[model samples]
Target: MTTAFDTAARPAAVPGDTLVLAGRPLRDHAVLEETSRYAEDVWVLTPAWLRADQKTLRLDFTLVPPALVDVAKPLFLALLAQDTPPGELPLAIDSIRTYFGCARRFLWWVHGRDRTLRELDGEDLDDYHREITALRLSGGATRCNRRAVRMFWAYRNVLPDHLGQDPLRRSLWQAWARVHRRAGGENLTDRIPEQVVAPLLSWAMRWVDDFADDVLAARAERDRHRGPAARGP
Candidate 1:
């Protein structure tokens, strides 16, 4: 199930041969291809909308950089052992590949070629996030970038404990992205009106109070069951 990328693992395409994205060379396809026994297909996606009933989805060749591939070959091989369905295995593999590619692009833009992942700090991450947001890449693409960087840190066990106080960073950025887009345009309004907040708060507060009472009762019952000798008499 390993998909390690090395000279032996290279596919039909190669170092001299190029993988093209919009007519420009993106990377060597051989380096990016998953060579696992489970990898029966390769899929790429372009953010097209699909209906809920749609079962068949088409993917193109994923764009990746050779340098990033070299850096992430271990992660790539690790993904081959994941439990993706046969039909979706290719997409799953490419999704992980795309994530690393996006992270590589961000790092390249920021540090040229000198910085190590261990040396990256909160300021560097902040700058990268701001730059990516300004670029306004497709939501899926942006998410890949965020997820890949997070996973890399998670793998190294070095993820930041505090992500600062930006509301976007504190909450799910994807959900907020949807809300921001809807506010700018797109009108399908099942969203709660601002005026409904006060009543909703009142309703929720009642549940909170009831839950607090239940907790107190449970504590009292536990205390009562303790024998006098055991209850610090």
Candidate 2:
């Protein structure tokens, strides 16, 4: 299981049962030094119990690398912070972070230097995808990375004068759309009919929800067992 505090560690908020840690720059977080170039900040969230004792605490953090934040903080804020419904921010953030991280790594692999999103052309994108394909990433991972690249370009194109001046951008967009619509292993969801996919999703969601509820119940039960004296003054 992916736990909290995978990268940086710092204290944050005490919102209800969830503790939201502040974002710490990658340079200061040693645990993330190797991956820091890809991220901007790390947000750590955990159940209150896990944080009650420092010595035994285990942290799992949400990484917001520079690749995602440097160029698109506003976009993420609008989509993840403002639009996401309550109790779902984690999922939204995770999706955004994963996609952005992959996109940044792909770009870094191709360019090997700092470059604006506007400067990249379709060839850069095609090369990255080709290299990733050659690496033989798992089907799901490749699809995820492709989607991330698509999302990055989509948002970047929205910038003023970004796409109007460059026809290559349009070609790249069209190429990805063709890939996206095609029937293949990389597009499993596309291959599956909605009727078949819906129940599978519903079942999976229910299982996750039940598992979370059980874990919370067990934690509460453990606290109750502690009693007033065991909890200390």
Candidate 2 local lDDT, 74-177, one digit each (tens): 33433333333222233233355565567566545533645555566666566666777777877667777776555443343222212112222556545655
- lDDT per residue as tens, model 1, 52-166: 2323322212333433433344333334334232222322433554565665566465345356555556666666667777788876677667655554443331122212223
Instruction: Highest lDDT: give the candidate number.
Output: 2
TM-score of 1: 0.37
Which residue runs of candidate 2 sit more than 4 Å off their true CA positions? 1-40, 45-68, 82-93, 110-113, 157-233
- For model 2 the local lDDT of residue 100 reads 54
